[model samples]
Target: MAGMVEQVGPPGRDDITAYAAERTGGASVRVGALAPLTRPGWVQAGRHLLAGMELAVSEVNDGGGIAGRPLELVVRDTAADPRRAGAAVEELAGLGVAALAGEYHSVVARAAARAHALGLPFLCSSAVLDALTEEPTDRVARLSPPQSHGWQVYADFLLRAGHERIALATEPSVYWASGAGILREYVAPRGGTVIELDARALTPAGLCDELAGHRASALLLLAGHPEPAVSIVRSVRRDPRLAEVTIGAPAGQPEFAEWATLLGDEGTAIPFLRYLPERLSPLGARVEAALRARLAHPPSFVAFEGYDTIAVLADALRAGGAGRTRPAADWSRVTVEGTRGRIRFSRTPGISVWQWTGAPVQVVDRDPSEPGRFRVLHGG
Candidate 1:
């Protein structure tokens, strides 16, 4: 498979005629994938995600597929809209998909509550809202760390970096709010003070002026989207008063390269928590090479996540057999090796549902001179 990583072509089709002797006969297992494919906010990332999913599906089919059955992905554009996401779930369910995956927005993932209600297994690829997996559901599992866990990683990094007073610049969304709340919860009890600011209401110059009045060591941008976070970063770079203050954002993970491109030299040294580190494992190197061969640029963390989601689903289908609902116990026992590390899901103490808690979160920074180089500061 190492030599085949760079092979670019259409995925192989399962030959049902050649598999007539198989016990159950050959068939394609359809998996539903919901992503904001055409939405302006997430289209680029969504495309990379789709590519990753396709790569996994291709690899699976190449290896003779699950029990001689091919895996087919039926993707739909949710547009990051909750109503549209709900409709997509119903449509995929109507199509009789064996499983579901790929949701980028927390709001859209929440709207996919129909998957839980319908007893369809949904492996969430990237949505990080804490509430998405806060309640137990036999049919739902999230591969990404929750927003609270990511914030906890960032908060710990800040504390370790000697930041005592933190300023939170947040967008007006449930995702951002949940992240901010988690950051405060983690920081406050540890003798750190957090001051909140409205990221959406403030202009670049206005944010600089507001930050000048506060005596904070660092500013944590909790905006889930790139616009406000990019605005905040540009403002901080332009203002001399904020020169010494470290600017960071957990939401910057998916769009780090794009933000770095836009910010140029100003983007350097801005710490952010990313699920995958700058350094790739041997498996990650192969995945990266494969992605670079197919994509215009290198794949993002979400792309790797998309690949992992489908890979896990393939494992579930194999372990539980096709067209059958596996008990949550059986699903919990299934694990696969991912690009980052070992992938597994478990119900944590605070979080009520099963989720992949072992996110290889690392605080990374863009290099000042190297165009695409990133330095891993801590963790992972």
Candidate 2:
């Protein structure tokens, strides 16, 4: 009683650290993981997801563990396929885990429905699809920015850049189409028109000819990947008239530098809401820093989403009493600043409620002033 002694548990548990240490002495807290760990495209995302979860678990164990039980992680590779995701979850559930986390692809999120049905806590790591939270369901919570947040920023960038007539290029895939739909919906009522383009039917040259014929002021490239988008950017650059048009892409990534080089003065990269300077959440930053430090590489937007997923699960576990967080946790006001800003839960189903946040979209004009650096034209 030199200073003060406090009891942290209901009964028989006095010292929190010591109690956790004793409880965790031999037992392991198992967490289920579902991600595409093998594919190169998903390599960074998968690693970052595991890295974040591992860091949180290590930090907890270092802090004397959760109720004295050391956290153990069980990961299953989903290979970025939705069909494989279900099998992976079944494998994890068979392992008898306390909680599950990590998901980069939306299709993988379908597994959460099963996890929810099983009364198991499903922590979303990287699934940005808004539909995940649209329906109110227990045991599933996301720690990443929803796709709608990302789409709003894309639309606003077009409006501010003086883009009047817009064209959309989107694949038939669910995620790509979902984002494209958001962009179209945002543009429709504002006196702006969205022209949908079919990738399969039209070549880059065909799109350029059509844009030239229509005199569209701007174009939004919403394809599934950068491979085709880059070709379109190149095609647009070739036509002197098309070069004057504003070009934007949702979630324009580092690969865009190539397009920037090709378009030269004609290109403009729309800032993704996820990459905005102000969108970085505190927990997201911590998770990002930890993963990058360990992997020796910067985490991409998708990778950051993966990291956010793990952090959310850890928080839920810590907030809930030892081994009591499955299906339900005391996360009513719990806020985790993920890579996309403050992520908070809502009562809605299939859509995890999040704070409204935006970032300045940079319009890069290769200049005599900066040479390589692209200057900010709209939101900075």
Best prediction by lDDT: 1
Tens-digit lDDT string for candidate 2 (79-146)? 77776777766766765667777777776775554676655677776566787744566667665556
**Whole-model alpha-carbon lDDT for candidate 2:** 0.60
**How does residue 243 of candidate 2 score in lDDT?**
63
Give candidate 2 misplaced runs (Cα > 4 Å): 1-24, 38-42, 255-270, 275-289, 301-304, 321-328, 333-344, 348-380
Model 1: how large is the Cα RMSD against the reference? Answer: 4.5
Count of clashes, each model: 0, 21
Q: What is the total number of backbone clashes in candidate 1?
A: 0
| Span of 10 residues, lowest total lDDT, candidate 1 | 1-10
